[model samples]
Target: MAFWTYMLKCADGHFYVGHSDNLEARIAAHQSGTIGGYTHSRRPLELVWCETFGSREEALAAERQIKGWSRAKKRALIAGDWDLISELARCRSRG
Candidate 1:
């Protein structure tokens, strides 16, 4: 089974990171406020990005890593700007 790491753009213009084996169902839960947490309250979410992994561990690791990123870094990822992603990582390492 493939696991997925996904990002949601919340009502308040913030991002949420999550991983699940059933991406569609998980996003549905968040959208319906059934997820019952940050995304729940934020409401009206839009899935901005998703990446599939071969294993649950890989998906979870990607989720955790993305969660620690700055908003700009996340935006870069959502835009599929690989150059900016690498530049941001370098800047983060320097500062």
Candidate 2:
């Protein structure tokens, strides 16, 4: 089965991170207000980014890692800014 880690660009201009095996259903749930919590408060979200994984464990790990990243970092990923990602990647390795 395939799993996916997604980033939603919320109405509030912030992003929400989540993982699911069924991306379509999950996004529908959020759009219809069937899901609650952070995303509920920021309704009408847009799918900003999504990466598929071969396993749920990989998806979950990516979700956790993304959730811990700075807002700028997350935005960079959403924007598909590989240049910025590369810069950030290098920064993390610097002492």
Per-residue alpha-carbon lDDT of model 1 for 1-95, expressed as tens digits? Answer: 99999999999999999999999999999998888878988989999999999999999999999999999999999999999999999999999
Off by over 4 Å in 2: 92-95
Model 2 over residues 2-50: C-alpha lDDT tens digits? 9999999999998899999999999999998999898998989999999
The pairs that clash in candidate 2 are none
Model 2 CA lDDT for position 19: 100
TM-score of 2: 0.90
Deviation from native of the Cα of residue 39 in model 2, angstroms = 0.7
| Cα TM-score per model | 0.98, 0.90
Query: What pairs collide in candidate 1?
Result: none
lDDT of residue 61 for candidate 1: 96
lDDT (CA) per prediction: 0.96, 0.93
